[model samples]
Target: MIQGAGTVILWSATIERQADRPLAEVWDNLDAVWRRFNDHEWLSGKAHGHAHRVDGYARHTALTVNEQGWHPHFHTLLVVSRNMPREQAVRLAADIAARWVDAAEHVGVVASTEGQRIGLPAVALPTDSPHQARRQAHREAVARVQYASHQAWGHPGSIAGTPEGVFRAAAAGDADALDLWHEIEEATHSHRLRSVGGIFRTPAAPRR
Candidate 1:
């Protein structure tokens, strides 16, 4: 997870109907897409500039390929820096979508996390029949919050321009917020304070 006040973009695509192609071929295509993203000059420049000014923003992305026995697709999650204007975010997302669509006609890409409503899974309390029920309950509570964060934010990363929302969501048991805070803290490991538990432990202060 990447921690910052930015947006996350998700790009996904289903495999084509070329049933005769080997699995390696599919992977190769996906790899090419990944390489293309890495090679994008705009991405590199924005990432470098953001990192230089923001103290902790940099390149944080996850690429994965899922294979459901003949039903294959790829998912990429990208986290950008904070304070970026929504227009710029939309433009960047559009550019990436255009690139992917150009490469694969069947690819389906969308940008979310802004004004979109998402449902979270039901909260599950830890088992009560164990001697370590208290600890288990704490862990379960954390997990519930994390899951909600992922669903609402599109990734387990920090959100920009929505600090209050992020804090509220996390306080409401969004586990991804904790994960994002942890990632941010880990990235700034040189700092004396290692834990972000205090930063997010309570609900965000009311906006002025």
Candidate 2:
């Protein structure tokens, strides 16, 4: 967390799992939507009709394939400019989720706004200062992102559950999983898995 940072949130987006599109095509569309959402001016800062609140962000994207085709999405850690109440943070999450949905639709990707989740800062103790509260929130945000990344591959000790299951099956010579793995490699080659944006691009930005 940086100075004045507040309201950490976790946001996610993924395409329709059952879409019949080829893996490469589906990945391309999802990638396009992500780029669109990232570059949207409305999300850069304060907008014409709404306050975007966000000042910096870090994103981590993952791609996994299973029986449902390709599943690719990013988990973002958003740092707002100031501390906000939980209700306000929830509203902000919804607003950002709606924009993400719009970006996906514009790129011909079917996405669910329901998956655009948010996690607020931890409750501060009566004696904690504003900076302490923000630091606590950042810690929670990092933990949530880590949890989300692992949960995507299913719970521990479940070898048959995906998206980890796909790889396990492929190793065991499962024909479908093998094919999906091939496509996954082709689609993800040379693509970036992490990104930093806005004030995070500055040298002064904190990295933790």
Candidate 3:
């Protein structure tokens, strides 16, 4: 398991879904923002100097259909230095949120800062657990927060935002839901549902 400060900083936002826009087009827009933020803004040191504070990060994507149309968003978990102060972490979160909004605009999606959420790390992993147990606890922590991961339904806030709910709606003969399911499947056919970068990325194997 990757090491961290035992805290997870979450950053998420969605593009405004339009009724007339194809889901593939909308997905491409959001995907572009994600790529730009990760490449040019966050890791590239183009905007802020907080990139060094990040120890590692993971990203998960999910899609849902609503009255507004297709709602797709990214759930990014950033693990910062263990010694980072709360105030610094808060500033880092705010910076990331701002960059997210900027990234959206560059992609022609006018996203609001209010829609971007900066979830602070509220829980700390136990310090006394064995190595294996500690790894399990870390997985549980991530699974609990990223409900889209489909690892666990530990939170009971909303189901319509999950893939399971999309399928349920399709089963119920909801046309919008069916369309969303099909479109998302085609849009993300060769894409990864979850990704890791920074220090979380495994180093390339050496040639023999």
lDDT of each: 0.39, 0.65, 0.67
Off-target runs (Cα >4 Å) in candidate 3 are 1-7, 44-52, 125-141, 144-158, 172-176
Q: Which ten-residue region of model 1 has the weakest summed lDDT?
A: 191-200
Candidate that would win on lDDT: 3
Residue pairs in steric clash, candidate 3? none
Q: Which model, 1 or 3, shows the larger TM-score? A: 3
lDDT of 1 by residue, 1-208 (tens): 2223334343443334234433344444544544454453434454445331211111222222123212224433333324445566556656555655454533332222221222222334333345355334433455454565467556734433133444555677879655444433343343221111211123468999
- The whole-model C-alpha lDDT of candidate 3 against the native structure comes to 0.67
The digit string of per-residue lDDT tens for model 2 on 1-208 reads 2223355666666767645766678767777888787664555555554565576677877665555666677767776656666677788788888878888889876777877755553422121347546445544456665565455534546445344676888998899787777776776675667777755563566778
Model 2 clashing-pair count = 0
* Cα-based lDDT at residue 151, candidate 3: 33
User: What TM-score would every model get versus the actual structure?
Assistant: 0.37, 0.71, 0.75
Model 2: per-residue Cα lDDT at residue 166: 68
Residue 19 of model 2 has an lDDT of 54
Best by TM-score: 3
Give the distance in Å from residue 119's predicted Cα in candidate 2 to where it truly belongs: 2.7
Distance (Å) between predicted and true CA of 121, model 1?
Answer: 15
- Cα error of candidate 3 at position 93, Å: 1.0
